[model samples]
Target: MMLSFFDQFMSPTLMGIPLIALAIALPWVLYPTPTTRWLNNRVLTLQSWFINRFTQQLLLPINQGGHKWATIFVSLMIFLLTINILGLLPHTFTPTTQLSLNMGLAVPLWLATVIIGMRNQPTHALGHLLPEGTPTPLIPVLIIIETISLFIRPLALGVRLTANLTAGHLLIQLIATAAFVLAPMMPTVAILTTSILFLLTLLEVAVAMIQAYVFVLLLSLYLQENV
Candidate 1:
């Protein structure tokens, strides 16, 4: 029986237990813990530097009140980044490719930002549904449209991450399969395909990283509006 290219996206199981938890937990373990020593190792230094820079850049557009979210933003970014890159390796599953997992992450965080906005500034939050200078005739229609768009935010977040990762993985698999099948019968063609595959792999690695950053960055933007 031939397996689907998407079989790689499925959550792996061992016996009766799902390994998704392990895959999610693996990123934390792979990171080097900071030690008490005055001089840190190169790995720890690079890790610290990356975290600091990312947090700084992420928080820049956010308000002072939204600064409280720095930790959550940075942690989620690192977690997603690690999972995404790791999934590119042979035999690893990409959890973010699953709509369920992406929505699970998206809804709660997106809702929290929405809630904060409503709680902190009810008038301002409600005002977002109907912008200023609207013609009386179109007021009702505009509010309805804006309200629908507001509700669609979380769905957009979840689908964006899932779709990008899933598309990249599928494309990689298709190209790799082509390269493999052509290797024996058409060596020159296989070589050209292999080169394209290599470049695509590099592009996928970048897409993985960018998608993770965009996910976290959007959350921060939502929080910025509320704060």
Candidate 2:
């Protein structure tokens, strides 16, 4: 009974947005949980040869409080990625295609970098924006320009991800729509369109991972600039 309601509400793109939201929020809920599922905590041997240690640095140390912030960034990316791919399924929606959703992800990451970096050493972390070696006369001008660019990371990341996903989805939708109209007279058109759609799906998979990686990597780099 409950499952049916879940299925009903999940139709069209609107349904997928909430699911993506859930995925995005999951890390927060799971952060305090120390009791791990068997799979997360242990490794089985192929021939009863060895038991490899599982719980190491890869777990993201949400419990430590020190690394909890990194966990959140990684979790957000994973959530966006899961949602982006979900839209590819028939009858599902693409959350990342929406600018608001992508901005929601990017803005927070940008804010986190600023907050964390500044908290480390407000003045020192900020110094990273200016050139390492610069004339005193030009320093003021350079700092102002670089500060503006720093402010733009959220905008840039948001636009790039949103545009790519939105455009890709629209292209695939148009091609698939065209297939129906052209199928009777030119079946090959549908075939070719489908082929293109398949290729784009593969491209989307790469984009999903790459975009997330880029976001996380850049955030880390920003942190490294200060720490």
Candidate 3:
């Protein structure tokens, strides 16, 4: 039976057990835990530097109250970066390709920021539903529009990640399939296609890293507004 291209996005199962949970858990195992030592290897040193830089950039605009989120944000950034890069490997399934998983990651974090805003600064939080100096006639319409936009943030976060990753995966698969089919029939064309595929793979690698960062960065922006 011929397999469908879209089947790649489906969560893999082994012997009736879904691997999505394992995929999510596996990234933590891959991370190098810091040991108690003043000195470290080059890899560890580089990892620390990257994390510090990312945290600094992410928190620069937020208030001190939001500074407490540094650990959570850093953890999230690493977790996402790991999974996204891991998914590019052969025989691996990408958990983030699923909208359900993406939304699961997104909605709670997004909701937390909203809840923090409401709990700590109720007036300011609610004020986001309406702008200053609104005309009397447009008040209701503007409030409705802003409210819709506010709630759409989480959905946008999830969909943006899912769409970008899914599109990249599909493109990669399509190119690989074409190259495979053309190899015997047209060796020259197949080589050219494979060359293009190689470049696209590199681009996808960058996309994987970037999409993860963008996801976390947008969350920080939302938290900045609230805090």
Candidate 4:
């Protein structure tokens, strides 16, 4: 008998996700070190000047003085990258393929773009929301189009990651499942498909990294452009 989707959900490993999250979060929660001090000083052995250069641009003034949003950004990228890359293991799956998870990462960036833009340039941000020199007769049409595009940026970001990563993962899964089903009947064919699928899973890991880079780069660009 073939397995059902619900059969996979019933596995004990599903509980591991929360445990993994706790493991990853333990440093920040229990030990509670400053991200700037932790990452800048020793995490990657990054030089002080290098850390200062990036952190200066995004320092947010808080009660303790300037907190490094730059470090936070780096942390976020690293965490997401690890999650994606680790999914290539035989028994693991990338949660980035889940729409809810991808959107959780994306929606904040979208909101941050608007918030930072407005904070940096109050009057100018309103103007930047629409293009310059609109024809009087077509101003309404132009506004509508630009507004839609602006809103769609984050939606596009979410869809790109969710669709591509999920599709690639599902393709690998189907190929592996096929190989398993055929193994007893056609040993040679099963071995060939499984070999190819394993290679493809490795390729998918590279793709995951590329997607993360693209997403983060685009986010940084939006910050620079709007601010």
Candidate 5:
């Protein structure tokens, strides 16, 4: 019974091939491609506008050097955003809910930012370990703590994304199961549970979008510090 709740998170397979690859690739196919026409359909127009706005806002704080990351940032944001929202659909699997996948996305990107900092400005990057005017006694302790915190960034990014989506998915399933079990025995209670489920579904949708944005925003902040 306990495992049933988590079964949705497992990667489904057909002919011994994991379907997660298809799930990850589906978002790209869903979006319409741009054409040479001056006037695009409403879908393409909206896509362009949203991408433009997101790119501008994301790069606003970044230095010109960091601005070079604009394409990667926008693409990641769209990929995450689409997958998260699509995962909310019935019978669909969410790739971002997996810690391994989230870490796969977070670690390299986080490392890239750190690498940029170290390569471009070694002094400034290393300086983050210990602040100015530190007492002689606390210097060692502070450096160790800061270094630990620096390494934990990728872990935090992965765990944060995984935990939020997992919790929301679990809650939705629990409420749904309850609503189904109680429908005949306690119609009133089941109705209330269903209503709550509807509200929670909406909140989860918002969370999906927000988490994607937050993930990218943090990367941008990391880049800002480095660049």
Candidate 6:
């Protein structure tokens, strides 16, 4: 008997060692490395094409200085894309579903952008705390509000990724269980539920891809402001 649906979100373990570490590292191993040859393999060619296109589209709006982050952001986007999709497979654990793992990724990168802004343009960074043409009565309140929002950016990033993935997974599991139980009692209802599950799976696939893009895109936006 299942006690809680949330239990599936818990990090799986083997021999008292958390398997989330292995899941995190698995994406790198799965990627095909490029070989030095006159003609590259299809996998290597396709990988290069995708990365080039993604980097070009992602960094087009940012300044020259922000272009330096192209490699970091591109790599992160691929890593996230891989992990998010892999979690959809049967019996697989998704590290991104854990708020701790998401925050670990979010906080450092977000902090780096903030630090860059402060170090490179202190006046401009502080200037964001208060908008131009503000009334004297609201200046203090606005500053406090902006400061809180600034700090909340990382939290929002982590929570957004976690919530989207977690909700999709929970719904999938819930519907699957219902279909299983209904199959024995009412085959027609079970078939309809199964059909719905198939459509939901397709939607979840799109969500997985989109959430990965949104995560990296927001990080790039943060870097844009600082650089």
lDDT of each: 0.92, 0.62, 0.94, 0.67, 0.95, 0.94
Q: Point to the candidate with the largest lDDT.
A: 5
Once superposed on the true structure, which residue ranges of model 2 sit more than 4 Å away at CA?
1-68
Query: How close to the true structure is residue 76 of candidate 3, measured as C-alpha lDDT?
Result: 89
TM-score of each candidate? 0.97, 0.69, 0.98, 0.73, 0.98, 0.98
- After the best TM-score superposition of candidate 3, give how far the Cα of residue 212 lies from its true spot, in angstroms: 0.5
lDDT of 3 at 97: 94
Residue 199 lDDT, candidate 3, scale 0-100? 98
lDDT tens digits by residue: candidate 1, 1-227? 99988788889999989999998998899988899999999999999999999999999988899988888998999999999999899978888888999999999999999999999999988898898999999999999999999889999999999999999999999999999999999999999999999999999999999999999999998898888
- Report backbone clashes per prediction: 0, 0, 0, 0, 0, 0
Candidate 6: regions farther than 4 A off: none
RMSD of each: 0.9, 7.8, 0.9, 5.9, 1.1, 0.9
State the local distance difference test value for candidate 1: 0.92
Candidate 5 — what's its lDDT? 0.95
The 10 consecutive residues of candidate 2 with the worst lDDT sum are: 46-55
Worst 10-residue lDDT window, candidate 6: 1-10
Off by over 4 Å in 5: 1-3
What number of backbone clashes does candidate 2 have, counting pairs of residues 3 or more apart or in separate chains? 0
**Model 3 residue 157 lDDT score:** 98
Judge candidate 6 at residue 79 and give its lDDT: 90
